[model samples]
Target chain A: MQDYSAHIQCSACPIRHRAVCARCDTDELSQLEQIKYYRSFQAGQTVIWAADRMEFVGSVVTGIASLTQTMEDGRRQMVGLLLPSDFVGRPGRAVAAFDVTATTDLVMCCFRKKPFEDMMLHTPHIAQRLLEMTLDELDAAREWMLLLGRKTAREKIASLLAIIARREAALQLKKAKGMLTVNLPLTREEMADYLGLTLETVSRQISALRKDGVIALEGNRHVNIPDIDRLLEEAGDDSDGGMLV
Target chain B: MQDYSAHIQCSACPIRHRAVCARCDTDELSQLEQIKYYRSFQAGQTVIWAADRMEFVGSVVTGIASLTQTMEDGRRQMVGLLLPSDFVGRPGRAVAAFDVTATTDLVMCCFRKKPFEDMMLHTPHIAQRLLEMTLDELDAAREWMLLLGRKTAREKIASLLAIIARREAALQLKKAKGMLTVNLPLTREEMADYLGLTLETVSRQISALRKDGVIALEGNRHVNIPDIDRLLEEAGDDSDGGMLV
Candidate 1:
């Protein structure tokens, strides 16, 4: 990890409009600026190990990170796929509850926990925003539960792609419709971990979907959806929308 | 549903101390009382359906409710298992997002959504408490994701029982240790749905646990854990503590 605190300004931060500080007014932004720092991590770096006493609460300003848990014997489950603007850590919690790792080169805008918690008590905007984000996270977690518990392997694969593509579109203020493209944010093994499937199964399912013309591939990591609606149908979702969290 | 507003007061409510309004002072309590009402549902009744226009936000006062999502092809997944003091509806969301069914006879204390949203804005204590609760719920949901995605059938069943027993003990300010007892809140089929297993799988696992003397059972619902530590071990959890959400 490296401190890039001096390299960025909150005003120039790419995720400023979408992060935990999104609701902050000018004065509030300055207040946040007082406590905020930036931490950068390389791909595959462990950001926080479970049970570590984290000194900060933060949000991803760039790239992706994963929140995962492992069993006693070593089985792993990916519980959260964090994207740009997604808040990380719990305000009142000092100990990290899950292993957080950067899935790609990442940057986070962080605030010291003590000051952040104190500020939350005094700032309605910050607290309200955090609450809203937490609720959204809960909803996402529940939806992920549904996918893990009920969806078939192929459906799970399709759902993961659909979720990524839709979110990608959302970031651009558009709908994932007739034709679109998306990058597979997770690798095959990571996808397997996230979906609770064997890596072979994930590869086979992706191949099956490709052979069925539901999607086009530009390699293992880039996906082209020839028809997004058909992809949703394959994902066992409604055309209007599916997989909100 | 029947109105039971006259039968209860917040001061006498069983879940008051643990509920959404847990931090409310006298003035806040009175304001809440003015907007609150109680609705009761019989066992096996539908409390709310997906896409239905819900009129209020609420919390369960008694009994259990299951939040479920169904695919167009009729497959279902139990996404949330609501217990007493568990919140019922999203405060700002007027459309119910999942099918909420009473797994047992249930009573909910509800507040109209508009006022509840207004009150949340004005009451820092309420918002702060809600944020805390929401964060806790998010943690629980993530742990559920781990269970659904990683645990074996036997481990899943053990985890569910262990979770219930722990929560039951928590209510009494006791730790679930030697010879603890708990009731199966969901039927075999519901457990099957919740655990991503076939009904036979759930039953088989339960029997296997009994045969191993990891648990003892009387009738279909009551369970006796002769060794809670052993039970937690079987649940793929740490003996010191595990499964907080």
Candidate 2:
């Protein structure tokens, strides 16, 4: 929807100042410009079919998206969440392995797959940045697996809240104080899917957490954590708190 | 435990012919020989704590191991199964983030953490290989997330069996027959942890699969599939056979 392919135009994009291309010179950015494109998806739209032939790879410029896998019987799991500055699609792979869906009105900074792969060969920084990002994703996925496989329903809900609180806090660049508040971006059903629970279970756990004073509700999709430490405790996390509960 | 640090010599090691250092010339091999060590662990031994300061990183030279995460209340999830040739350790980070354990009598090719990191910097090929391996591991982890988060207990068991069968078949380097036999390497409780189910549920599902003619049980850990396709169907796999299901 946004035409960003005209030239190597960091002057107009804030993300260019700090994203993976921060170190790129004009020549490298010009090469990227020749291959890049832009695309948009409305909320609730599927961006790519699972296992479909993918023609391009890109990063999120604005809005949220999800990487999901589904069973033949229609059961689904959300594997990766794409936020702004997050890369999408795999290099050296021809087809998309998961269905990517827009969780909000989405805009992506894209690149033609063939040219991007070729450029990756000549550009060490791009590959290096990608490796760093992939490793980070892997760590997050492993942490999620812990939640899915081992955490109690109550702990799972608290963990999710803590994660959202941390992310939203980071996005807004502030520390939460007493009665720290943020909006829940996901529906109850989406939360259930991400936490491996039913919607009822999610609702019940949220209510329980509220009763325990770990969190309070201002309105639907609005959460207030009285103390971040208490929320982390409810998440069943240790004191040395960098593990995402 | 072997005092491999004292016996740090690679001259007679079995893995020398087929390891990360296999391509190195005699001089390079000798250089590696000075720093390399072999460590062994008994079955069910904890190799490293999740939050411990790691002094070394290694590759599995023989036998089986697992990477796992545990909650404060004792809930545990096995996040990774390490077969021979599989690597362990994080680059540019010190300390273990997950517990590593030996699931069978295990031997590993190890290097001191600092030296290994330094070696990685100088040997681009080694870094390249590590990148490739980590990418594959990331893919497997994502697929496992689907099973843990979405599939029913019955489907999880079927999917796990199908995966083991496929891996065994590949290792043997032969086309599988219409009927395939597999030695189940995991106990019911271990399977339960891997599948995100209780042991009772795991046992019940195994019984149900056998009763439904979806699988034939020869013993506690051996299974026979009359048709791989049937098992795949039981796995709720896509018609196109993408590994997602």
Candidate 3:
């Protein structure tokens, strides 16, 4: 886990233009600065427990976290994955609805809930940006629901890889094409929770994809795509591979 | 379908305080009125096909509509259900991502896309309210994901019943409890799609619940819950059954 706690100016933040505060002007940014602080969590740490009152709202500054639900019988499902620049916490709701855990060493830029809510009331840019981000998250959730409800095990694994690759490509500002390499952020167990499969199934599917040449495994945590379009086809998504135009 | 095309003033609208225009002042309402129109669809009518261009955004004024996705092999999944006062259409995006179909004869209050986007920009209240509504929808989507990924066939059916009953109760300003009757807006086939089950499985589960006295059938579409708590228990949800307060 990298320690990034050294006070960095908001202007110098890597996710300045992509986070919840993306639309804020200098004055609005200063207002946010007064109420904002950074917090870090080690990998495997629980950030917030389900049904507990949340004291702040924030955006992921680095690393990954997941929102998950646990059943009475000990079954679990991952509902949302927060990557760099993804927003965390509901603005109006005080209680967290799912348990949030840091999947990797994580850093977050957080705003005290009440002050942030007050700032949103006075800043149209912040409110509008948050709205756009929420809509995007809703769309992503619906897409994941389709995968959970209908996709085959192989398709589910393929879809998860494609999603992660697309996000990684976006972060690098590069079009995914002939060959791409991605680091699997979650473990086999975590992947099982996200895809509604068992760890054994996840391992089998990965081995299948590798044997079929859709992907090449460099190590347990690394994947190399020989052909991005082929992988997308297996995923049952558009062959364009979600290229940003 | 109701011909609500007979120009009802926004001031008298049943959802005036609940829809996207919830925060609008009299002057803001007049601005919305200038660009608004009414449209109605018959039961089973397709409102918009997935990936098609959408020309307008609207609020459901009556009846039920659903957003669904169909795979190449004919497997379908219902991603969203829109009841009275639910907003439809993405504001910033030009294309519809899901096929929206009317499950019952439906009425909607619509605004031309360009005009509605313009109105959203100038009316901070409208934008703010839309943000709030979108957030609520995101939460609902996450909850649905949990049901889709982690529940058993029986639990899924019971959960669906609980959700519909809760929504119906909320519409009437009452909490779901005691003897509660709900008119299911979707057909058995549609219910199967929403629950990610075969139609036969859905039917069998419904019959099993009836036999177990968790619910009683008035007709194919009408369900009477003698004890709402028992139904919730079967649903594997919080015993309070999603009471707002």
Could you estimate the TM-score for every candidate? 0.92, 0.87, 0.92
Candidate 2 residue B74 C-alpha distance from true site, Å: 1.2
Predicted structure 2, TM vs. truth: 0.87
lDDT tens per residue, model 3, A88-194: 88788888888999999999888899998988787877777788878888888888888889889999999999888876675555678668889899999999999
Better of 1 and 2 by DockQ: 1
Candidate 1 clashes between residue pairs 3 or more apart in a chain or in different chains: A140-A245, B140-B245
lDDT tens per residue, model 1, A136-186: 788778778878998899999999998888776766445566678888878
Name model 2 segments beyond 4 Å from true: A1-29, A239-245, B1-35, B239-245
Candidate 3 Cα outliers beyond 4 Å, as residue runs: A1-11, A14-16, A238-245, B1-11, B172-177, B238-245
TM-score of 3: 0.92
True contacts kept of each: 0.78, 0.66, 0.73
Q: All models, DockQ values?
A: 0.72, 0.56, 0.69
lDDT preference between candidates 2 and 3, better one: 3
Off-target runs (Cα >4 Å) in candidate 1 are: A1-11, A14-16, A172-178, A238-245, B1-11, B14-16, B238-241
Model 2's CAPRI class?
Answer: medium
- Give me the overall lDDT of model 3: 0.80
Docking class of 3: medium
